[model samples]
Structures are given as structure tokens and as C-alpha cells.
Target chain A: MKSQRVAVLILAGLFLYLSLYTWNLRTGHLDALSNHTGLEVSSWVLRPGKWVADRATTLWKRYVFLVGLQRENERLKDEIGRLVLENADLHERDRTVNRLERLLSFDPPVHWTRKGGRVVAQRLGPAAALETVLVDQGDLSGIRPDTPVITPDGVVGRVMRVGLTASTVLLLTDPNSAIPVISQTTRTPGVAFGRGPGRDMVVEYMNVNAGLKAGEELVTSGLAGIFPKGLPVAVISSVERSDLSLFLSVHATPLIDAALLEEVLFLARTRAGEGH
Target chain B: MLGPSWWLLYTFVGVWAQHFFPGMDFLAPGLLVSLQEERRGNIIWLTVSWILLQEGMGSLFFGSTLLWYGCLILAFHLGRGLFSSTSVTLMCLLGAFLGALHFLFTLMIMRLEVMAFPFERVLFEAVLQAALTPILWWVAHQLYPRRLRSDERSV
Candidate 1:
């Protein structure tokens, strides 16, 4: 009888898993969960925790070490002051918002729309470098499938799976992560892929002879429609085309720290009924 | 059935160790223990959480981890009667087996993307798990002396 009960339990678990797997594969559970109710609750839950935790960390690092904190703040404030007049802050925020508002308002990019959700979690490394995270919202939150996640900084990743109250984010740093990127400076474009060993992203398909240089900004070209036009993705950190390979694998550093992400915004609803 | 307290101990230790060590994850061990305790129903959650934790540290999904660990637990638990109750050899074997299991599973999960990928995280995790499991088992045995001797030891 005991063994029978155990067998029944295992069978139930197996049933649950198989059903979910089948159900998700067809409907894109990740998208559903991200836009679901979970997304809504997380938006509210993570904020308070983040606010408290950020305050605590800032207080401890700044207040506990008052003199050093003040010095660092003074330096940062000086830097902000210089960039403030140049509209640096506005340029950063408006780019993400405006890009979404434009393409969605213009045409349904591939008959798809976008949903925006607050990033509720940031996950980091421990082993073979997964570089993924959990977002607090899912299908019920209007989070959809294949939605590109971004921040004022740049592209973070896309929604992978959405649970009832949570969703998994595949970070741009994982080996599975890939994005199309173009150089704003030289107009040279390539495909960006993450290698597990580092924080850098490798760009493939560029002309091996293109005058590629470091520190160039890379942005989404709006060709894929997965991302809105002209969202900053990364800065070119390297250039490499081995004699053995024809594709020049230029590496770039993602502007957003996927590991340190506290919140991610899901661009769900577009102005044209598809949010960028 | 494993006590809730024991589980809480297993779960929280992973968090505490991960918090302090900065570059360590003991979730595989917890998963192994869960499987060993016959909590097979919870294995999915275990594996999912383990995968999340593993990837959270920045790894690619290498398949066959659950298969390999399942085989190890099945082999170990089934072959338990051959070993003595308090034999050091038994402890050593357990440690060695666990270490090998952990290392192999780690490598499989880490390199799930590329075929025949070139890296040896398996050997690294095997050594770490083998070293750690025995010490942890020994400590648990000391803490719950009678439970260690009860019918649970039959496995």
C-alpha cells in the first residue's frame, strides 16, 4: 500500500510536468505568465522591497562610511552635472519610450504587439554562467511571448517562460542569447551572441574588412520587430575575425548589467495596439 | 518520509552557504538528498529550482543531469545492503559516489547547449560534492543519532 501511494504520487508529478510541457509549448506559457497577474503583483511587491533594500544598502555604504560615501557622491554628482545639460538623462529614457511608441503606432510589426512589465528580480552567476533571472509577472500580466526586455540603459533580454506569478528571463549574457545589432557610429551591423565565459557579446556577420572599432554604440535595427527601432544594446568591447572563420566575431559589452538587474520593464502594449 | 525540519535545514543551508561563499551552489546536493529520501514527486520542482539556481550563476542548459543523478541514486540506494552499517569504506564509497554524481550532473547542466562541448566542469563538481557530502552526512548522523540507526539506515 505504501509503495502504491508513492507510485501514485510520482505518477501525478509526471502527469503534471508532461501536461505543463505540452500546454506551454503550444501557447507560449512564458509570454502568458509575463503579462499575467503575476506581473502586476510583482510590480508592486518588488518596488517596496527594492526601495527598502536600496535604501539600506545606500545607507550602509554611504551613511556607515560617511566620509568616503560623500566623496564618491560628490564625484558622481559632478559627472551628472556635466551630462545634465546635454540632455543625457532624457536621451536615455526617451529613447526606449519613443521607440516603442513610434513603431507600434505606425504598423503592427509582424502582427505582434509589446507589453511592458517592471523587472522584479536580477540573477547572477554561480556555475557554467547561465546569466538568467526571474521576473515577477507572467501571462496574466499581459506579458507576451518573445518580448524583448530593456531598460534606460539598454537591452537586457527576452522573456523565456512565464509561470502563474513569475517568469524566467533569458539574459543577454547567456550562450543561448542572441540579438541583431548595428553600429551607430560606423553603420556596420552584425549579430550579437553571448559566450558563457564573459560579459561580452560577440557580433557575427560583419564584413571581415569593415572598419570596426571599440567604444562604438550598437542599437537594434528594427528589422526583427522583436525590438523597437534604435534601442541601445551595447558598446563594442572587442573585434575578432579568425583566419579559420569568415565571420568577424566582434564582442560588445551590454549596457545593462544583466546580473545586477533589479527590475525589467516589459514593453507589452504598443501605441498601435502593439507596445514597443 | 523526511522531516520538514531536515528539509528546512537542507534548503536554508544552500542559501546561507551561497550567501557567504560568493561562488558556490549546493542545490545539487539538496536535490540528491530529496531523491534519496524517495521524494520523487517533488523532483520536478527540485530540478526546476536547481536549473534556475544553476543558470542564475550563468550556465547553459546541459541535458541528462536528472537522468544521470537518477541513475546514481537508484544504484546507490539499491546496492546499500552490501555495505556495513558503520564502515568507513561505506562512508568513503558514498562520498565518492556522490562526488562523481554531482560532478557529472553539473557538467551536463553547464554544457547543455553545444554538442560534445569541450569543458570539464564535471570533474570539478564531482570532487567538490564527494568531499562535501560525506562531511555533511557525518554531521547529520551525529545530530540525529537514533534516526541514523533506525530502519531508514536499511536503504
Candidate 2:
């Protein structure tokens, strides 16, 4: 009799849970609730811990790691001087392009405003199945699903979920992530599909004679409607022609290292659609 | 002695631990300890909080955490019939069970959701979960307040 009672209780509980789960799947109310509460609380906890760690590292580096500081500063100064000359040259070219565009009556480009956020953690908790990182910015910071995340080096990923004050970024290294890309020089178009973490992503659908060579850069083609066009994504690592297939089996190394990501810039679309 | 305040502290520390050890359930051991102590109200609260936290952070659907803790509860109850509830051996066995469950449950959920399976990383985390569960349980058991014990309530 007792066993029967327990079994009935279990069945009833399962039924109720399933009903709730189904409702949540449809409405997404429960997911938002948990994100607002649980994800927010975790971010609050993690932020301080990250702050302390950053401060300690800064203090140590500033005070203790001074052996090569002078040499590094000299090197940085020379690089900055070179970059300033390059910047002036680029500015002149930009002015010429603007003049040419005005004369040709080309459409204005889409503008992106950048919001910076620090990565607090990577794939936290039991439910984090994807190769993801927790960024300390969320819906409040205009971070939404599919918002492009990038670094100075290259593309990072896109915002997957937004909580109140934190968001999850699905890294480009995750197998689920794919981005449309074009070769920098050859202009060969293909889709770059991630092949799990720590593995080079595969570029699919390019013709065997596409002329894509090793070390050639791949940039976002903006066909996905998420990432802006012409952002550096990856570099061609290996390209092979398979007799059985019409397309080249090409692999690329993502420009940004997911494991080394500390701070990322989230790109939000501008109101006027002019990104300089 | 375990109390509301202590539970809050445990949760704070557990969150930190979870941050350090990604993809492993740190609070499951606390639930196991709570079960051994027979704290019904605390059990419910902890389970709910943990479920929310795990589900919120996870990429899969919410029901996976429900199934995870549900299986843990069922295993604990069934194992209690054959072994002492406080036995370290029982915790180790439960930990191993949870480890295997993590792999199978994650794969099942990934399949259901049609997401790519992260076979090797999940396998590594499963082994970690198996090893960490009993150790965390030991830590929680050791740190539990003596004054809050049912036997010591009168004193």
C-alpha cells in the first residue's frame, strides 16, 4: 500500500513537472525568470571575485614585474609611432572613398556601436553544455541574442542569452556556431562551421578551384544578418580537394582565441546606420 | 549546526566553487548531506534554488536539472535501504552514479534539443563530478553546525 502511494506521488509530480516544462518551452517565461534571478545573482557574486583577481594581477605586474618594463615601453612607443603614420594614410584613403561613394551615390553602410564587457567565467554550472563564456553585460546593456561580440584581434562570438546584468556568448569554436565568410583576397565565399573547441573550424561549400590558399584571411560576409560585414573572423589553415566531393575541404584557425578572451566588445546596431 | 544563515553561506561558497569548476554540480553534495540530516524544508529550498541556478546557466531545457536531482533523490532513498545513510561508501557510490548520469543525461538532452554533442569535455567533467561529490559532501558534513543537529537541539 505504501509503495503504491509513493509510486502515485512520483507519477503526479512527473506530470506536473512536465506540464510546467512544456509551458515554459512555449512561453519562455520561466527561462527569463531564472535568468533574471539566478543568472543575475551569480553575476553579482562573480563580479567582485573577478575584480579582486584583476586588481591583484595588476598590482603584481605593476610593482613586481618590472624587469623588462623599460624595454617593453620602448617597443610599444615605436609600434605606436608606426601605427600613427598608418592611421594618417588610412584617413586619407577613407576621405577618398567617401568622395568616390558620394559621386557614385552608393548606399550608406550600417553603423555599429560598441559596448565593452569583461568575461567573468567560462561555461559555469552543470547546464553549460556549449562552449560559452559569461560576460558581465546583459539586456540592460543592450546585449541581446545574436549581438556580435568581437575583440581588437577578431570576432569572438554572438550573444546567446541575455540576463538582467549578464549575458552568455556562444564561442565560435562550438560546433553549433556557423558564420558566413569570404576570403580576403580571392573573395571566395563559404560558410565556416565550428568543429568543437580547440579544433580548427571547417569552411564548407567553396569550389575546389576557389583558389583559397593557406594563411589567407576570412572575413564575415554579413549574410547572416547578425555580424557586420568585413569583420576578420579566421585565417585559412589547410585546403584540400576531395575527388569524391565538388567542394574543397578547407579548415581555418579562428583569429581570436576563445580560451584567452578576457574583454570583448559587443556590437549594437546604430540608429543612423553609419559605422565609422 | 545547519541553519538558514549557514545554508546561505553554503550557497555563496557553492557558487564560487561552481565558477571554478565549470559544468560540474557542486550543490548536489549539499543536497545529499541535507537528505542524510532529514531536513525536509531545507531540502526543498536548496533543491529549488539549485535547479533554478543550474537551469538558468545551462544551455539545455529546464527539465534536465529536475531529472538530475530527482534521480539523485531516488538513488539516495534506494541505497539507504542497504547501507547507512551517513556512510562515506554510499556517497562515493552515489557520486559515481551521478557521474554516469551526467554523461548519459547530457547526451540525451543534447539529442532532444538537436545540439552538437561535446563528447570529450563532458566525459572529463563526469569524472570530475564523480570525484568531487564525496569530497564536497565530506566538507559540508564536517562544517555543519553541531547546535542545529536534531540530537543536540535540546542541549
* TM-score for all models, in order of appearance: 0.61, 0.85
Q: All models: lDDT?
A: 0.57, 0.84
Candidate 1 per-residue C-alpha lDDT over B38-93 given as tens digits, one digit per residue, 9 for 90 to 100: 34556666565444444333323322333444444555554466865444565567
Candidate 1 residue runs with Cα over 4 Å from true position: A1-129, A240-246, A269-276, B5-9, B12-69, B85-99, B102-126, B140-155
- DockQ for all models, in order? 0.18, 0.62
By TM-score, the best candidate is 2
TM-score of 2: 0.85
Q: Which ten residues in a row have the lowest lDDT in candidate 1 chain A?
A: A33-42
Displacement of the residue A95 alpha carbon in candidate 1, Å: 21
Predicted structure 1, TM vs. truth: 0.61
Best by lDDT: 2
Per DockQ, the best of the predicted structures is 2
Error of 2 at A94 (Å): 28
State fnat for each of the candidate structures.
Answer: 0.24, 0.67
* Model 2 residue-pair collision total: 5
**What digit string (tens of lDDT, one per residue) describes model 1 on residues A1-276?**
976985796687657645654564467543243234323333344446657876677555434444444466687865655455346447746975675564345332353444545455544213433445667666667765577777667887887655555676777776667788888978877788776534577787887877888888999877776776677888998887678876677878888776566556666545554543
